[model samples]
Target: MSKAYVFTRNGGPEVEALVDRDMPTPGPGELLVAVRAAGVNPVDWKLRKGYTRPGSVPQPFPTVFGSEAAGVVEAIGPGVGGFAIGDEVFGNPVAGGYAEHTLLPVAVTAHKPAGISFADAAVLPVAAATAYDGVRQLGLAPGATLLVTGAGGGVGSAAVQLAQHAGVRVIGVASASKKAFVESLGAVHVEPGGGLADRVRALAPGGIDAVFDLAGGDTLREAALLLADPAALISAGDKQLVAELGGAPVERARTAAVLVAVAGLVVAGALRTHVTGTYPLSAAGEALRAVEDGHALGKTVIEVTV
Candidate 1:
């Protein structure tokens, strides 16, 4: 039997449990992966509390708890190509990822680079990939300045680095405690809160070229005023708020090509998957708490011993 951390119903932590179940066989175009690591994100807990992604089909009861993981391929389903048994791979899993074994769809999976660790690759699918999509959608040029709120979180941290790599100057707004960390990503750090727009204007008198908001609600509403063209504002935070402000949500292209590019960037030393903390599969609840509490530094990953 394969062990997995799962929630039996839609609710809070009370619904979560760890149990042993029969290992799932790979479906057509799927790969059975021996999960080595799983990445934790805010959306994981949100989904645990019954929040569904727009238009996502309803999941069954006793659902697994993760979507991003990296591990070795144990078997490939019929009709799948470009992957083989014993090959290391990472990307979006077919179902939940917090398990001893999980199935991965071939369409989104990419072979793990030798230089990248399973822990790091586990973080790319949701966080780093979103960062790549958001920055590319903005299409800021060299010398352009982009203001990013929630600059210290997982997706925000990746956005900061990706934007800087694209030759755009990034002004990262996070907490004072993360000033040094955000700066290390090559962004000018600004503490968020009251008078944030004034503070941002103090740094960029010419006005910010674009706004990439990772924090929703007031932070997003306030930052939208900084952009001259409303279209320059984009978000991965809240689609409703972004639309109300005349800006669109970050366009996500969850493709194998993007995953390959991110892995390539890691190999080239251009991108760093800063995993700040790791917990064993037994401690999945604690790991989720770290992210849900909003205190996780860069990224938190669950190391599955299987």
Candidate 2:
């Protein structure tokens, strides 16, 4: 039997529990991973509250609560090639990542580099990859200024760093508490909420070349106004709002190639996971709570020992 932290039904934290279950078996093109670490994100709790990704079938009850993980391949399913048992790897999970074991589809999985730790690799598939795609989609040139809302959070923080690494000047909008944190990523920090655009204007009078929005709704709206061409705007947070504003959602290239690229960036010191918190699998709930509470400084991971 394997232990997993799961939600029995769609609801709040009340529905979540740590339970024992049979070991999972990987199907064709999948690998059963002995999870060493699982990254926590807002989507975990959002899914527990019944938010489904577009076109993704909902997992049945007692569903696991994570999106990405890193571990050794315990077993490889039929038809899967280029991987062997005991190889270290990380990727988006087939089930959920918050478990002793879970399945990872080969299409999204990548071999873990020696330089990256399990905690850092666990977050690359989601947070770092999203940042990678959004920054590339904007195609901002060096010396161009990019505005990143919610810059203190996982994706936001990664975006800020990646953009700066590309020689783009980044103005990060986050809570006052994360000012130092955002600035540490080399972004000019701007507080969020009312008057966001004006403050950003004050920071980059020449104007914002693009907006990579991780904070949606009004924050996205305000940032959109900073761009002379709405086509320069892209969002990972509020897709609908961005579309209505004449901008597009971040075009996610969810492939092993993209994962490899982001992992390489981490290895080269061009990107940092900025993992701020880690919990054992037994304390998965607290890890989820930290992200769901909307104040987690960076990535949170659940480290599983087996």
Best of the candidates, lDDT: 2
* Cα lDDT over the full model 2: 0.93
Clash pairs for candidate 1: 66-97
Clash pairs (backbone) in predicted model 2: none
Angstrom error of the Cα, residue 259, model 2: value is 1.0
lDDT for every model? 0.93, 0.93
All candidates: TM-score: 0.99, 0.99
TM-score for candidate 2, residues paired by index: 0.99
Cα displacement (angstroms), candidate 2, residue 171, comes to 0.3
**Which parts of model 1 have CA positions greater than 4 angstroms off?**
none
Give per-residue lDDT, candidate 2, residue 269: 95
Model 1 Cα lDDT, one tens digit per residue, 166-264: 999999999998999999998999988888999999999988999999888999988998888999999998889999999999999999999999889
